[model samples]
Target: MTTSTAACAFERKDWLDDYAALKTALEQRYANLAWFASPQGGVDLPALDKRTRRLLETAEDESMAKAALSAFVSGFHDGHFSTAGAVLQPKIAQPLALPKVDYSRLNATQACAALGYGPARGAAFSLPFESLPGTVLEADGLTRAFRSGVVAAPDGTRFGVVRIARFRQQDASPAACEQAWSERQAKGAMSEADVKPVKQAANAAWLRTLAAQLQHFREQKVAAVVVDVGNNPGGNDTGDWAVRLFTAHDVHSARMMMSAAPLAALYFDEQLDGLRQAQKEQDPTPEAQAMLEQSIAAFEARKAGIAARGCDLSWAWSEQRPWQPNGCSRLIDAGYASGQSSYLPPKAFGNLKIASSIYWAAEVDDLRGAWNGPVYVLTDGGTGSSAEMFSALMQDAAGARIVGRTSAGDGCGFMADAPPVVLPHSRLRYRVPNCVRLRADGNDEVAGVKPDLPVLPTEGENDRERAWRLLDTVAADLRARGAKP
Candidate 1:
């Protein structure tokens, strides 16, 4: 990336040799190099790669070497780290709302509508439901009903509600797979190469419409079950049965791991060839043929542990004392490697796809116990990635109760299928986070889901009166823990 006679563009020493080949491809395929060597992962990465090589040695051109390659991937303050081609992932210009305009004549996605990026994804967070208190049984509540709605409480307790707005197509899609993904993106194909059987038939049609809306809120006996994912913005965290279909039991997921390199085993061998092209586009269901032969034997044991420790590794990212790979470490396959986690069972719980891509849904193990009662997710800060993986799996495997705030810190993304690091002289494109997940306090759901009850939203409050005053303070903390409401 460093040759220049100025034939075409990217001059400044070809953007500092594509920012030292994206800092040696994120220090040999990044997966949070032992959380940038811990101390609760403060992140130094060799002093942010020596201050982004002295900000790309005072680049004398190409927008300061693309702002020192986005300030060295925003100093790895990660969220699946970033970068992109043509234009996106380089916005930064927010603080200015009140009668504030002309942000240097706005452009970084309108100079920031709450932190913009690829379609400036921060705004839109509504589903009003005309001031709550019953009757919102769906009819376009965020596009024909995955917005179910309800709230009550004041000594009576009711609750129910729904609204996820995303886990990739938050529910109603199937128009012949959205016209075959708009005719394969008008021929520029690979919308994630047939997006996992078109999102395993839109997650088996939103787990049979969220198992008949959690069996119609346990026959309308609702006393708990909020799950809003407010301002959602994330999608298909392997679309895990959107937090194991609203709990009746068995939730336990997020262990996941990867990064042994060789481009993370060819990005999970292109996610095991898109699960062998969605098992040849149909014909799997002996429970989707044993969960697509156990995710093609955990993508062939994560491509033979990245080809028996596939070389090219690096660490000492200014060590605070963590880097632990005794040869391309970070695993998770010894058949769902227990004791230190790595799971997915209950018919590969949470949409690993069974009942083969919804032939009109239902019967994916009758969509799991379908609501065994008191659940509560909420969340905000525009929640993110698999909606913070269903708010950290409804606060650690469905005991639910998360309330609001502290999400959007983008917990775990890019699970399988990779191929977008490109940079050689401004071809741009970038990527990071080879895969992590964790979260059972062992941390690393990209450090996000934090609400045991944070709430926040008073000044001019409104998303339906701050989501019915945070689900009536979660029904007064479930009636001060007596909970039998």
Candidate 2:
């Protein structure tokens, strides 16, 4: 079909039909749809639909149609629920240009303060600083220096600090690096291989910088180490490296929920079976054999109950499992035990079976780490996704005090991996989250993580200055208790 014809073909009737189909599919297959649709709180689907229909009717062009769809999906209030395509990519904002700051004007004392150090004896701040006189201290300069560095407190006592702005995997393998290079080349973003480093340096720098700072803190016997993720926008979940600097005990952070109970049950079955087989091959001890048997029996019983409810497990065998769990968790309590009903009925004979074989629970763990120190995490409304995950871990696991405002609450709990749905006419794409993240308390929305010691920036104070003030406040309190080194 011609472009103009295709665009004209997407009439009100066509859009209405498509909307109905998409809504039905989400209700039937999307795991966290019910949670987002719950009466307690969730997107008002009817209202959203009304708004969407109105936008569609008045839309003057293809771009308008796409914008309407984008607005409609954003109503779900999930960061992970987003679109991606050639058309959508341009709409995404790129990183801001760093502002140039004249650090030459500031004297040594002002420079130290700018770097987050106080003038009092034994007073330390966790700001990123290189050499005192030579450092540029501009926006980008500070960012690079703060990625990892060490500086002296007023009393000549050295302190360490590492700024992790995101949680992406640093030091990707050679193959992955090459693939990224190729993609960049294809986009005409980069031309020469030599122009890029031999390896991907973004995440590697973050990891190495953090490790170096931690090592400096350990060697210098700094009073305490500060991990700054105040402006973090969140990324991967592999940020446990920072936590391991202080402790090694497993810390339970958050629980995860699958799209459906049948999918979770099938996963449990596979895990249990793998354990049973491994034990059999190892010629298990009596205790091991007994444990394996008990686990298998339990799994079998659960499967039998699901079967009795007329649920089908055949769908689990598909190569592309529509609903894949993103993170891991230990089963704390079953859905039935908590008197929680299944989000949806199980599949039976290619239809939804009217039974409660679906299992769910409240308690689950997300980011596990061993950090047992006097940790203080700085957060702001921008903290989201894996960044929020890190904040939750610091509070729930290490008992770290969170200072600053509440987090952005991006709902990494319900992460979505589904491919965007492209509109044939407008070429607009829409996406939805597939998984649901729940805290131990059974809540997963964008309400954000609250700070223990709430501190907001003053009239002219930036986040860094506010953070420095809070650190000084914390240090003062600790000193009063004779806790300073």
- Local distance difference test, per candidate? 0.60, 0.48
lDDT by residue (1-485, candidate 2, tens digit) is 99888777657655655555555545434544554444433456557777888998887665676677778777876666566556454454686888643444443333334333321221112232334322222223132323444444333434455565566432222223334344444554332342334233433444444445555556656565556666576766444334444444544435554444354465456545554554544344564455446556665665455323332322221212222233111112222221123122112112111111221111111111222345567677777777777777667655666777788767654332445655544455556454445554566534467888787768997645555566565565446546443
Write the residue-wise lDDT of candidate 1 on 1-485 in tens digits.
44464434546676778877776776566666666556666667678777777777776667776787787677666656777546445546885557634333333223223122122122223435436666345423343336575557556577777766666542344432444344444555342344545445545665667668878878878787776767876766434555556766766566666666665566556556655666664555575656666677766776776656544445545556543434344433322112112333444334533322221112244577677777878777777777887688778877878877887666665655677788766778876767667677776666678888877878998777776777678889988886542
Worst 10 residues of 2 by lDDT: 359-368
TM-scores for all candidates: the values are 0.32, 0.58
Which prediction has the highest TM-score against the true structure? 2
Largest lDDT belongs to which candidate? 1
TM-score, cand. 1 vs. native? 0.32
